[model samples]
Target: MSVPVLLVVEDDRALSAMLAELFEGEGYRVDTVYDGQQGMHRGLTGGYDAIIVDRGLPVMDGADLVALLRSKGVTTPALILTARGSVEDRVEGLDAGAQDYLLKPFEVPELLARVRALLRRIDNAATVVVAGPLRLDRVTRRVSGETPDRAEVELSEREAALLGTLMAAPKRVFSRAQLLASVFDGAESAGAVDLYVHYLRRKLGKQVIRTVHGTGYRFGME
Candidate 1:
C-alpha cells in the first residue's frame, strides 16, 4: 500500500524537523519546507494527501498560501499550526481554507487525531459501505470480499476507497470525470480509474463493477 504523503510548511527549523520525523514515524511520507513560497510551490506541484502549514511564514504566510490554493481549486486538506491561539486567529485560518487549526503547544495524540480526521473528511467514507457480499471498512481501509473460489480478500487503500465510493451510491452511474475528481487526488489519471475498476472486478468477480457503455461505471451484483 502507498503511504499517505504530506507537505509541512514551517519556518522554524527545529519544529519543522520534529514534525517531519513525527509524521514519518507515524507511517506517512513527509516533505518539509522552510518558507511559504517554497511550500506553495511544492504544495501546488506535489501530490500530497494533506498539508501542515505554520501561520507566520517568511515569504507568503500560511493563510495566504492556503487561500490561494483554495482559489485555484486545490482541494487537498490543510491544517494550520501556529502560536496564535486566539479564536479570531482560528476563524481566520479556517476561513482561508485550512481545514483545521492547531496551537503550537499541542499534544502529539491530538495532532494525529486531527490529521486522521482531515483524511477521513477527504475520503468521505468514515462509515462502512456494503454491496452484496462485499463490505468496505473505511476506518481500516480494508475491503472484505469473496473471490471466485469463495475465499476472502483484503483490498488496498485506493481499492477500498473506490469500492466505497461506488457502494455509497449503489447502482448510480458515475462518469469518468466525476470519479477522477472524487477518487484520484491528482496523483492518478482517468485511465487509472478504469484500471482500478478492472482490479475490483477481478477480485470480487466480473459482475461487481458494471460498465455503463461510453458513460462510465456503476456498482451492482451481477
Candidate 2:
C-alpha cells in the first residue's frame, strides 16, 4: 500500500521535528513547515492525506488557514493542535473545518490514535472518486467513463492505485518519482511509471492521463 503523506504545521521547531520523526517512524511520509502561511501554501498544493497544525502560528492562525483551505476546496482532513482547552476554542477549530483537535501535552498514543481515526474516516468516505468524465470505484478497482456506452474497465491493483493518485489531485501534475513513491512505494523503478501509464492508456484511452513534457503527468480527459 502507498504510505500516507502528512503535513505538520507547528511553529515550535522542536515539536515539529518530533512530529516529523514520529509519523515517519510510523511509515508515513511527512512534510513539516514552521508557520501558518507556509502551512497554507503547502496544504493547498501538496495533496497531503492529512494535516496537523498548531492553533497559534505566525503569519496566520491555524483556524484561518483551515478555513481558507476549505474555501479553496481542499478536503484533506486536518487536525488542530493547540494549548487552548476552552470549549469555544475547540468549537472554533471545528467550525473552521478541522476534522479533529488535539490539545498540547497530549499522550503520544492518543495523538496517534486520533490521527488514525481521521484517516479511517477519510478512507471510508473516499470509496468513489469522480474526475471529469471518469469515475473510479476504489473498492471494486473499476474505472468507468461517464458516457452511457463506455463500459467499466477493471484495473490491476497497481494501475488502479496510480490512477487514483492522479485523480485525487486532478489539478496537480505529479513527477515520476512522486508516482513511484506514492503508488509503488518505491519498490519499482521510476521507469515503472511510464510502463503503467502506457497500460492505463491502452485500457482507458489515451486521454486518461496527460504527460507534461518534462514535469510528469496529470489527470486528463477533462
Candidate 3:
C-alpha cells in the first residue's frame, strides 16, 4: 500500500519546519520545497496524497501557477495560503480555482480541520468528477487510459491535490491566494500557485483548462 505523501511549498525556513513537524505528527510523509519553481517540479513528480502551497514563492508567483494547473486536467485538491486575506484577495484566489483559502497567522486546530475537510472533499464520490481523456483513481492514486487497464499517469501529492480541487469545482475559477489557504495553509505555500499550475498542465495534458485571458483559469470546459 502507498503511504499517503504530502508536499510543502514554502519559503520561510522556520514556518516550513513547523508545518513539516505538524504533518509528520499527523502520519503523512512530507516533501519540502523553498521556491515556486522547485515546488512546481516536486508537484509534477512527487506522488503525494495532498499539497499545501503558499502565495509568495520565488521562481514563480502563486496566482499564475494555480491557473496553469487548472488549465491542465490534473484534479488534485489544493489549499492556498495568503498573507493578504482581504475579500478581494480571497476572491482572486478563488477565481484561480482553489478549493479553499486560509489567511496567514492562523491557528493549528483550524488548519487541521481544513485538512480533514479537504480530504473528505477529495474522497466524496457522490460529488461530481471532471477529467478528460484519462482514467483516474483517487483512492488508489492511479491514472491511466489507452488500455482501460494499463496506460497510467503518475502524480505527486501537490498534483493530486490540484486534481481533487478541480474535481470539486468543475468549472469555477480559484485565484492563487485561495489555492494557498485551501491547499497549502498560507504559511508560505500559496506563492507558488503559478508554478504548480504549470506543473499541472504538463502532467494532466494540454487543453485541460482554458485561460481566462488576464485573469485566472477554468477547468472542465468546452
Cα TM-score per model: 0.55, 0.56, 0.56
For model 1, the stretches where C-alpha displacement exceeds 4 angstroms are 123-222
Ranked by TM-score, the better of candidates 1 and 3 is: 3
C-alpha-based local distance difference test score of model 1: 0.78
Q: Which portions of model 2 miss their true places by more than 4 Å?
A: 123-222
lDDT of 2 by residue, 161-211 (tens): 888777765666678876775577569889999999999988988888999
The alpha-carbon lDDT assigned to residue 181 of candidate 2 equals 57
Residue-by-residue lDDT tens digits, candidate 1, 1-222: 778999999999999999999999999999999997788778878988999999999967687677655533466899999999889788777766688999989999999999988777654433565667777776676666655676556787777767766765564566776566556754777999999998888777888888899988877762
How many residue pairs collide in each prediction? Answer: 0, 0, 74
Please give the lDDT score at residue 159 for candidate 2.
88
Local distance difference test, each candidate: 0.78, 0.83, 0.65
Tell me how far the alpha carbon of residue 17 in candidate 1 is from the true structure, in angstroms, after superposition. 0.7
Q: Name the 10 consecutive residues with the lowest summed lDDT in model 3.
A: 123-132
State the lDDT of candidate 3 residue by residue for 1-222, as single tens digits.
Answer: 656677778888899999999988988788888887677667666755667788888766665456455444344566787798789877776766667789899899998788767666654442223455544455555556532234566767666666656544555666666566445646665547667778767765555555566566556433
